[model samples]
Target: MELSLLFEISMLLTSACAVLLAGWLLWQGQRQRAMPALAGFAAMMALWCAGHIAIVQQWPVLGIALVLANPLMPMFFLHFAVQFVADGSKPLPAWLQRGKLLPVLYGVTGSIILLSWLGGGGKVISSSGFSAFFVFQGIGWLNLLYTVLLGIAAHLILWQGWRIHSGNKRRSIVAMFLAGGWGLLLATSFVFPSLGLNWYPYPMLLLPSYLLLLVYGVVRYQVLAINAFANKALLWLGMLLLVLALMALVSALLGQLGMQALSAVPASQLWLYSALLLLLSAACYQPLSQLARRLIYPGGQLDESLLAHWRAELQQAQSWQELALRAGNLLSARLRREVSVQLPAAGDTATGLHILCRRDSSGWQYQLTGWDDVTPGYRLQGEVFAALLLSSCRILEQSLKLADAERKRLDQQHLVELGALSAAMAHELRNPLNIIAMAAATTPAETRGHIQQQLKRADRLIADLLSYSGQLQLQCSRLPLKPLLQTILSQQDWQGVQCQLKVPDGLTLYADSYRVQQVLINLTDNALAFCRNQAQAQICIETQHDNGDILLYVHNNGPAIMPQQHNSLFQPFVSKRAGGSGLGLAIVRRIMQAHGGDVCHRTDLGWPVSFELKFKQQPSALSTQIQDNIND
Candidate 1:
């Protein structure tokens, strides 16, 4: 009668646990990534009951069911470990993958365990000390190895959980698995055998539920999303569960002692006993850690603190290096995760990437104790900081663009005013230039030598005036630089003084060719006239095109402009010679400007007087001007 009653009570407790497990696992199947695995755990429990019925009826079919059930323990755990720490990836890899081997190994191991069970190596013993009963397994030391393997697998699952990235919600799930697996393994190994060997059954059957959250992570969003990690909901749930479990343990102890005293009470009073325990468990939760504070902090002292910090971030110069460091700090501190961002080489083509973090490699920043970068050997877990990472990238780009735009706007305004002043000054000087030309024309044959000198000077002045007033706009048609230089020199008969124009072939400039040629002509003319001493004077014009700037240098072994006047070279009416309108180089500078080019004095006094004119280049540097007319 005692043995049968014990079996009957054990069956009731197992049945109740099976029902709860089934309901929870089934509900969770729809939510998490490893629902199929959790359901497998539920089926294992439900089928476990059938093994007893099959044994009672002497049915042979229960043999298969019993054998298959053992593997479910590992299968569920392996699946949860994958899900809990986000190790599992879809389209699971073949033979090489940890995922593929898990289920496959379960099948092989289950067969071995089953063969052992049926071969008389294992027996189930029923125990009854109080109103509750449980079946204890007596197996050889080999069976003890089974417990050891389970313990090891549980440790792995727990380790995987704890290693999850810092900013992810999956960490909570991992923490739960860690706690439960530890509890289950310790209970079976030490707790059950102590104090007259009371086997209350696996108390931490909710590991599968946490795995459900991982499944949810896959469908809705990653489990380790920053927002999910920051959320305190699951943490509260875990605390509540811990409190309830402790209350039940305490209540069961006190209730059992009371039952010993009150022998008149029915054994079925265990239902009322369990109920009271659950209620007390619900009440024994950790103190609510300031619900009002969490809500009001955004608008209160915390808000003030955050605003001050955000303002400081704004004040920091938006250099890529500074922004990167700031982002790294936030990711490290807020998520409690370590991360490193690497920049691609100047020529790399990749747009984006997300790599897993691990422990064996130098994966993350130094602050994290165990975590490292991902590799085949190391697995990554925790939260995915994808959104935050992407956000930082965009913010950096925007800040750079804003700074560049502000600088360009200020520069453009100055250029526009300078252009206006040039136009006004050209208008003011035109009439005076014509009067000087008339005076020089009228001085004529009466004083021929002086008249000729004055006439020649007046002619040069008129050319400068015209060049200044041109206000040339860049035509911007693509043309070769060599042909343009040749054409400008061709207009000048450099007979007495030989000229050598050396320019890279196929170099093109995007500018008004007319204005660019006009500047070159004025520069070459000035260079040739200054070659005073030598009978065979030499003038060489060299062109260098780089970084979209065309640098044309007109050189002559002539007197150089004074160092003090270099800044004033392009200004109107500034000259190195007397009776000079001081406008030849000035006119060249203005024409270069109209073509979006600039002319600068290349070197210091008495050195080869070189005038450099620069212009922006077009798409291709290919020379395509028809008919090479520089045969002269």
Candidate 2:
């Protein structure tokens, strides 16, 4: 079989494959129409291969075919180049968009060739050497101009793409292929057949391998996204075009050797040979991207492992403290480094979710210095994860606030319980105290009267406790202090006591008269009790006005109080005498507070103990019944 026949058959098959693939790509566009330029480029490839097949076949109408595809080749080269490099995305200016003109230039060149072929060949070059293919022919030079402009445009766009693109090294592969192909393409326009050179005019087709690469990018990476299995299609097309071109060369050589016709060779043999080479080329383009990724990242590990445990601890982690601990443990296990995670102060949610996880000597302010979940690296934790941690901090803050509020509530409940217990205790003990007072009042003036008087002192202490605890049913009213004191003094029991009253006659104070009388009686009893052994045993009760209110004092000539133990003596459970319930002075203080007044201890001229009362202003007349009851 002649090699030229084999080559011709291969080119024919490759072109047919390209046409089929182009159809498939066009069909695919109906669904994903985002890649029109890719579809146009596909059609261009198919047409190009078809034109090459016709050229090798020497079809009678071959010149007509060239008219269709010659200029189309350059125009499509420029158009698809523009589309493919920019991924069909850049908008062309109005002047540049009438790109169909580029194709017409090739078509007209082919027409001139066709016209000469009809006129019986070789006239395509005039004897005067002025033929269109050899010289400008008024318009042939336009093709050269077109070629130069398009070439420059291609260079500029390619430079632009190359500048911004940081992709695989395929651009160099593509550039080499384009430069070689176009170099031959330009030289052929002037030198082919006209110069009588025996070399093939269409040897430029051999370089479609470069265009095949663009098909690979589109399929493998969706570079053009016309949706064809472009790598496979371009592989088949390139193998066909190369085999056909080589076969043409071989056929000419074999024909010169006087070889027999190779139409006898079965077409299947050529198809199989082309098929094997196509499959091989297709297999080779698969990238090592997956393998590269694994080598770079290694063992599915993240960079965050470099941060040690202690760094995690110093971060402001609230509820996520637990998460920080788990992260530390995992990091420690993986990196074989101790992970110390530090959190901000306990009970403070203000510093929440800020992590200070650290690796030994590799921490930034005790923070992890390497990549975290999505952050890529530190000095920048993932904003999303950080936000999640902050939300957890907020929750912790709310929980702390709730806990504090509950604690305060519990404390208030305890205070309420204490107050209730005091009220109940006062009521329980007041009955016994009132009974003692009753006995003391009834005790005979003849039989052990001194012992009965001592028993009276105990009663006074109990009475005070009852009033202060709210157990006493106080009968509040306007009462005259001077009249009440006079009534208590007028009674026979106090006649021997020898206390003088200097209170002005109608001095009034607002109070429960009975409670007021109880307070005065207790004060006088205390004074008399201390007045013993004095050269003159006497008590002085007096009233005066001060600061918009009436003030009263009960003074005694008695043993002076030491400078120490002043205000504290009025505290509950405190007393000068042993076995006192320590409530008398405390009661006086509380009653005064409730009445908007106060009671205090001071001293008279002799440094004898004295008690003072300041009362709210009121009418001077106390009720007659309270006066009568006191005097009785």
Candidate 3:
């Protein structure tokens, strides 16, 4: 066959690929704003390649379509480049923003070219020297100039984006930049044939190389987020195409070599040769596909050793939380994307490229998100990941069961210890405290008061120990917030202190009133102690709504808690303040937990120190009782 015929075949194949890519991009464009421009670019590329095919077949109308599409192609590319790198925090440069008019101008130019062609003012002449190509004459040269300039401007915009961005965005920009640059540089050769240079458009032979670069960008950098299912289908299609092409080439070579026996074979025996070729293709498919994938995505394959290591690590996990964290981290590191392993909760169905995992009986769900790219081989890797996760989740369930059993055993042991400790405190310590109180009655007024204070402190210490050890049974009720805060403040010796209550008069909380009072007393007492020495000692009780929950804050203008102590601040027997029982915050935490709430020390509220109590907003029958009382 002639080389010209081969180039024509190549152009047809390139056009087919370009059209397919354009459709794929358009489908992707429905979900992503950046894809329409890219889709348009691919459509123009298809038209341009089709024009070459048309010119070879001596079809003049479709041949002219190529020239009209030429300038418009790069304009689409330029628009895509601008949209691709657009970040809300960064505005487009003034000059580039003004350059938006270029597309409109090019669109008008394309229209003019089409109108002129229809009016017979312009013509496409097939090159007599190169049978596979064509040249433009008259106003057609204007379109070529427009194409060259637009191509350069598109590349410049991509270059700017590549320079301005970093990380994955930068890498994506680099992919587009390099691909467009190669396409522009090689594509420029097509203009030479029309320049009266007898040079064949050899660059057209490498036209598919530009598409390959774009594919690399799409696969490697995730320039476009193709679906995994689509990726799998494409991979299969590609392999099938490869097999067919190889078979055709082999048949053509056999014909060229003039194999007498093979050529002289009867038509009835052709099925045997076809069957042999089919068998050969089948035998070669797996290895060839694997080899191609290995070359394309080197890190995608899961090694046996790595799988074994992951299994061992998952099985050995001490707790369910640690197991989830380890699994998520391992997947994130392997996939180079974010992965989250969590207990499935109410609200959203798993979001953003997530897989619902129902691997184990316990039904723990994990999501793999942040899928910026889907390469050819990732479907196989994704299957492997799912299998690994399924097996790992069973291990996670076992670990959680074991942890629960251990906790039950420890709780029984703790109850036994509490019983013995309580006995010791009542027998050994309470007798002496009672004696001190009795002796205080015989002492002078000032001396008696000092002795009474010491007795009360010792009694309170014993009570706190018992409270911390024993499980609480709550009697929840609707308590008015402002009045509750007022009663607690009245008990405080904050005569000269600036005590502010920011609680709404009608605000109410559904909790055990006694426990709520105890929590407030502990928090307020701590705040008062901390800020007592400050020049303008102040304490503020504030409430804010948070996602149906109420946040109560007790903040003070006191010396900040040391950063080093923040970690263990809520632990029992841990205190920085002198003369503290070291059980106040720990007791407060216990009470909050019993109410299905939580308390934490915070420093972000413009106060030196603050303790926030989050009251979970659970609906209750008594919720409207306080409001009724206020109305009355």
lDDT of 2: 0.53
Question: 67-154 in candidate 1: lDDT tens per residue?
Answer: 3355455556566555645544322224324556666766756765665565544334433322322233433334445645764775
Regions more than 4 Å wrong, model 2: 1-3, 27-34, 55-58, 83-148, 164-191, 201-208, 217-219, 223-632
Off by over 4 Å in 3: 1-310, 313-375, 386-394, 397-412, 619-632
Q: What global local distance difference test value does model 3 have?
A: 0.72
Candidate rank order under lDDT:
3, 2, 1
RMSD (Å) of each candidate, 1 decimal: 20.9, 25.7, 22.3
> Residue 37: error of model 3 in Å?
73
TM-scores of the candidates are 0.34, 0.31, 0.46
Error of 3 at 25 (Å): 55
Arranged by TM-score, best first: 3, 1, 2
Tell me the deviation in Å of residue 96 in model 3. Answer: 96
Tens digits of per-residue lDDT for model 3 on 123-146? 555453455466666667776776
